[model samples]
Target: MKKVIAIYPGSFDPPTNGHLDLIERGSKIFDELIVAILRNPDKNPLFSLGERRAMLEALTADFKNVRVDVFDGLTVDYAARVKAGAVLRGIRALSDYEYELQMAMMNRKLQPDLETVFMMPAEQYSYLSSRLVREVAKLGGSIQDLVPEMVERRLREKLDPAIKLQDARKMKPGKRA
Candidate 1:
């Protein structure tokens, strides 16, 4: 019997809880689940590709069936190259469905053998997204619940340098400024 392989490709700027939820679920369904980071130079990502890959690796380390990887070019092409039977995507809302449906149709046309599987995150994470997490972190808002602690730390460190300064200032009440 052939092993089932699936590719979950995304920019994963900061891999939010929604992404992790999908990864966790996908890992169980496929014999091997590759969580691929799209290497798009045009995107001004808050987390570098390496950083994102590292966090995913750390986060999914417990899942023996899941692996973290990076890929460039079209997702369908990448899926074909990796011999993935399907492409996994998470749809959080109607807007996401419209866009993803179009992309899935196109991918189906491009690679007749490959399939697109859309899954919805748990209700608690339905509204979470990497872009939203980055925006919240950029504005120095708490992202403790949005992403993993490691990712949260990195996001704050990369997006808001002043957070550290403010924290230090708070630690020394007398040196307020």
Candidate 2:
């Protein structure tokens, strides 16, 4: 029997509890789970690619089959390079299906044999997202539920003390972008 390798590609920015849940669940079905960190030059995340990878590695340290890696360019290319049998996606809501479906379709076109599998996260964490986590953390709100303690600390270090205050000053009323 051929071993099944699944690729879960994302910016991760800062992996959260919801992400961990999906990863842990996916690892059970595939012989190897690749947690790929894709480069997004457009995103000025608080965490660097290396920092994000380290955090994820620490979070998933217990899963022997799970490995952390980084890649640039198209996901299909990465999937093909790794010989992934399936691409793992976590669906949080009905709205996400449209985009995910479109991506899956495109990936199928790129590689007909490659498959995409969607996993619905647990109800309690379905609504949790990286944007929400950052917004809460930016405003001095608690992120205990959305992220791991390490992620929370990283967020504080990167955004708190002085940087967050500087950003707040630039946020004038009616300035929404």
- Models 1 onward score TM values of 0.90, 0.89
Each model's backbone clash number: 0, 0
lDDT of each: 0.88, 0.90
Q: Which candidate tops lDDT?
A: 2
Best by TM-score: 1
Badly placed stretches (over 4 Å) of model 1 are 165-177
| Residue lDDT tens for model 1, 1-177 | 999999999999888899999999998889999999999989987778888899999999999999999999999889988999999999998989889999999999989899899999999898898888877666656677789888878866675675675466557867644
Total clashes for model 2: 0
Clash-forming residue pairs, model 2: none
Q: Which ten-residue region of model 1 has the weakest summed lDDT? A: 161-170
**Candidate 2 whole-model C-alpha lDDT, 0 to 1:** 0.90
Q: Which digits, one per residue and each the tens of the lDDT, describe model 2 over residues 1-177?
A: 999999999988889999999999999999999999989888887689999999999999999999999999989999999999899999999988999999999999998999999998889899999888888777766678789999988998987755465456557677542
lDDT of 2 at 8: 95
In model 1, pairs of residues that clash are: none
- Residue-level error in angstroms, candidate 1, position 118: 0.7
